[model samples]
Target: MSALSLYALFTGRKPPSVKYKYYRKYFIIYAASMSSFAVHTVFICFFYVINIPILSVINVFSVSVWALALRENYYGRHSNAIFLACAEISIHAVLATAYLGWSSGFQFYLWPAACLATINPRLGVRLSSAIGFGCIVLFILLKTVVDDGLYNFDFRKYADFFYVFNGIIAGISLIFGICSIRVINERQEEKLTDLATKDELTNLFNRRYINSYLSEYEPDADLENRPYCIVLGDLDYFKKVNDTLGHYAGDDVLIDVSRYLKQRFRSSDVVCRWGGEEFLFLLKDTSLRQAHDLVEKICRDIPDNIHVCSSQRIRITMSFGIAASTGVSQHEQLIKVADENLYQAKKQGRNCVVSSEITG
Candidate 1:
């Protein structure tokens, strides 16, 4: 399947269109909980083999806590799950450090917990940072106050191995938490970009985005000898539709027309919702004649293809005007020319295409 389909499958969200945000907290919590469960299960086995019944039983409780946290996360109780996870980690770290000493690396898990707290959206940044700082203070206290160990076990020989293993696991958890924060930031940036550049109702590029594109667009002089064309289209009697049929029906008509226009244009072309009931097209490497023909066909097809909105068949016509890039250095000049032609088309009569050549 496509990458978008795979993303939807994993995140349980459809592909983003206009304004869309996906909550990744559930995935992060679920993964963290499951990993914690597996790690504690391994610890339970290790402690049992090494004859530490207390630590083994503590690990059993850790596993149960993680399992419950996972279930809570699955049920959409994210704050509860996060609280459970943080509490379990804090308690388990202190207990493990007390039993096996700070050298065993159990206290390292507190670092990731702190990082997680700072990134959680539910907790304000100030409070989360304070919680993270508290974890750090707790870590320092445990290191200074805790004695070598409580139980004088015969597992001193395996101290280095346990230390290395727990250290690696803790490091991985920390890295995962950092990556989660990065992903959340990137997704937020994407949402902001979409909000700024896309039309909400039609999910088409907005006037601002089109203007930016025109400003930034630099033509490759060597490969692109042909001039591009700009076509401005306006829906005929659009105000009447909004006034008579209501704004809701007008929105449906705009959405349907936008979809149709997007499908009719080539992939290289830029289709934008210029403003209310108006669209702008940037046809790369297209002549005025070609643009006019394409737009004329669309104009004819719109009326024949009735748009059904709220059980009402709405037949709408569009007028288009085309202007080709002919020694026009400024993008605004080209758009102005296109707009003049569009006005001429409307004056002559609606549902027709007008071009610079025809007007000249």
Candidate 2:
């Protein structure tokens, strides 16, 4: 199966949307709970075989504690569930080390508890750090106070095996917790980048992102220094639409225009909303005549009936000004020339295309 499918199976579903604040926490806690349940179930059998009645009974209770934590997390009582898990792991580690001795390596489970304390966001950094430090102190106490096994059993001869087993499980738990934190951080970074670069309403490139693109753009040297064109477009009488029909209707009109522009342009071309009622388009590898023709066709083919609401439809038109990279290399120069042409189009009439080479 693919990695994405595996991730879905592990998390019990596809990743939740970024808007959900607690999704990452929920996933981490749920996975921990299930893993704890399975691990304790193994301990229950191991203790029974070794004839350690007290430890076996304790592990049976540990399995039930993990089950209860899982149910609490499912119901969104995340703080309570996390507390239960931390308390159980800490207690179990101390008890196991006291009985079997530190050579058995049960105290290593305390390290994962330290890591988890720091990961949980609801626990402030100071408190989490303190808890982590407490785990270290507890580990020292286990080493100094419990020098050897208390129970005289035949299984005590296999201390090395038990040590290796507990160490591996604790290491796996630590790796899992760290990987969960990494996934959450990467997802949050993606969400922040999208918010910075995209217009929320139009879902198109915003003015700031478009300017950055233009500033960094370079023409292909192998293509004989092919030129690009910039088109400045303004919706005619857009303010009048807002004055007559509410701002909501005006927003619907902008959304419709944005959708049309996105569909009409080539994938290589850049389309952006340059503030209220104005748009900017960058047509790569196009000449003056080609850019003019394209804009004229777009103006002619615009849909007349734009639906703003269930009962309302309106007709709208736009004016476009095109500037080709004939003598200029800088984006600022091209934009200034396009803006000047846009002014001329507004002066002559609305709903027309004006370029350096032709006017229509």
Candidate 3:
């Protein structure tokens, strides 16, 4: 049963562990280790290796204890189960090697265990360092004492069998541990990429992401002949709201506006928080006049009453500037023209839409 479970891990079918999702890889490792122990138990029982079956029984007992620890949320009441399991298994390997002789290749298991312990974030630095140093010291001592009569042992022809089997198990464990680490790193990279591109406040694409998108877009490469427009807008009197009510109120207003903007625009349109109280919209297959008309409608539909704190009722308004591809050669030029029109809207009293095409 244990051997079958171990095989599941090699095939990427991990057992379910809701409390220890991150440590679930170690659960697979534990299953594999238990299976290895079970094999040793069968081998020793068949050949009658003196006192070895007793040690294998103890190792099985250790696996049971670790399994209980995992279930009980032990190991500091968190998913540090892998670290604890690695340390326990490494210690067991050292003891088994000392008793069975280094010829059994049990010491080979220590290397992979130490590697896992050191790399795992769940394992404390001091604990990892101690285990790493202990493994190194034990390895050195084993190498030094192997030639002496005190350490030398022969299991007759069975020695070769034990050595080969142990080596294969150790190699498998190392590969599994390395692959787990790679999976963890890849997940972290994806999370970081999400955080980097998204705005913390409004959950919209930030200026950095939209700018990159615009920079990568090739105007001449539009084989489908789709037109696009840039609509740059900013909240009217947003700074006053921040100063009078508080930044929290300002945040509430931004959140409210962002939600409406998301609902109002097409999914193909890229709406971003350009910075501060400003937002930029990239509308595909839309003209500057259409963009302007859309913004004007959105400005009209904005609720007159927004709750800013429990007692304060605030009305929010936005000014927009539109620019289309027909009048501009590149996004940079379009953005500059749109920004200038945005300035014109601000100058023409707060809640209004201005376009470069109108100004031109």
Best by TM-score: 2
Compare candidates 1 and 3 on TM-score and give the better one. Answer: 1
- Candidate 1 segments whose C-alpha is farther than 4 A from its true place: 1-23, 34-84, 121-152, 157-161, 218-226, 243-245, 309-314, 357-360
- What TM-scores do the predictions have? 0.74, 0.76, 0.61
lDDT score for residue 282 of model 1? 89
- For candidate 1, lDDT tens digit of each residue in 184-226? 8898899899999999999999999999898766245213555
Q: Spell out the clash pairs found in candidate 2.
A: none
Q: Model 3's lDDT to the true fold? A: 0.71
Q: Candidate 2, 264: how far from true, in Å?
A: 2.7
Backbone clashes under 3 angstroms, per model: 0, 0, 0
Cα-based lDDT at residue 207, candidate 3: 90
Query: What are the lDDT scores of the predictions, listed in order?
Result: 0.81, 0.81, 0.71
- lDDT for 176 in candidate 1 is 81
Tens-digit lDDT track of model 3 for 91-163? 7666666766777777787888778678767668998777777787777776677522233344534656877
lDDT of 1: 0.81
Residue 288 miss distance in model 1 (angstroms):
2.0
Q: What root-mean-square deviation over C-alphas does model 1 reach?
A: 7.0
